[model samples]
Target: MIDNIRENNAFEADATRDEDTMENKFLTFHLGQEDYGIEIRHVTEIIGVQKITDVPDMPDYIKGVINLRGKVIPVMDVRARFKLPPRAYDDRTCIIVVQYNGTAVGLVVDEVSEVANIARDQIEPPPRTSRGKSSRFFSGMGKMGDEVKILLDVERLLYDEERLSAGLVDQA
Candidate 1:
């Protein structure tokens, strides 16, 4: 019994260490010319762009929902969310499925770059000067090599009082 307990404790320790390592990893994707990243821990999977069924009265950014293997999930266009000019979706476009507040939300991005391991020390807080509407979605700026990736706050991006009150998220 004591040996079994020791083995279980060792497994738990290894799992904790794995989680800690993942915490520093970010899944980088692009919008247009700029790169953005979200914590890898929150990412579930990446799929190619698919047909979206529009939901009425929702925000323009919320492109609609998609049936992902029988499960319906809301899809949000990152470009539209940022109020950026629309572009044609091509083969490079991808839908990054991520968990947001227990709900699965698919973020439509231009193209996925790579999974980058950005240490905590390499991350800097967002600037306080800009009061842009989209600024609230920025969590930090991660420095990797000669480039910086705009790290996003996934929860903040997905959460909206209007959507919650309308039960739109719950519908998916």
Candidate 2:
């Protein structure tokens, strides 16, 4: 029994170490022509676009909620949230379930790409656009070879009080 306990503890420690190493990784996805990324730590799972029950009195971007396993998760249309032109959901349309600020929200994206390792040095601050209008959504721009992925600040995306309401307020 003692030996088994020690082995289990060692395995748990190794899993913790693996998570620590994932801090520099980003899960890349796309909206339209542009690619975007969010910290891998925030992502829990990726699922196909599910039926979203409409919730009235909410923002247009807030499509509604979906039953994910036994949990009901709120879904948001990334395109609508960014004020992009709406498109029909195809096989490529999927939801990126992310846990941020203790809430699990499903981000409806165009498609998921791949998980890329973006070191701290490879990330640059977002450019200053007049009054930082578009910069608020980005944490930084991650450069990968010749391509750039706009790294999103998940907390800011999900928890901003002025931008979001109906119990999805910022906890921190």
Please write out the lDDT profile of model 1 over residues 1-172, one tens digit for every residue.
Answer: 9999999999999999989989889999999999999999999999999999999999899999999999999999999999899999999999999996699999999999999999999999988655566767789999999999999998778885455577753322
- Relative to the true structure, candidate 2 has a C-alpha RMSD (angstroms) of 4.0
TM-score of 2: 0.85
Native-vs-model 1 lDDT?
A: 0.91
- Candidate 2 lDDT: 0.89
Best-performing candidate as measured by TM-score: 1
lDDT of each: 0.91, 0.89
Residue-wise lDDT of candidate 2 within 100-151, one digit each (tens)? 8799999999999999999999999988665534456789999999999999
TM-score of 1: 0.86
| C-alpha TM-score for every candidate | 0.86, 0.85
Q: Between which residue pairs do clashes occur in model 2?
A: none
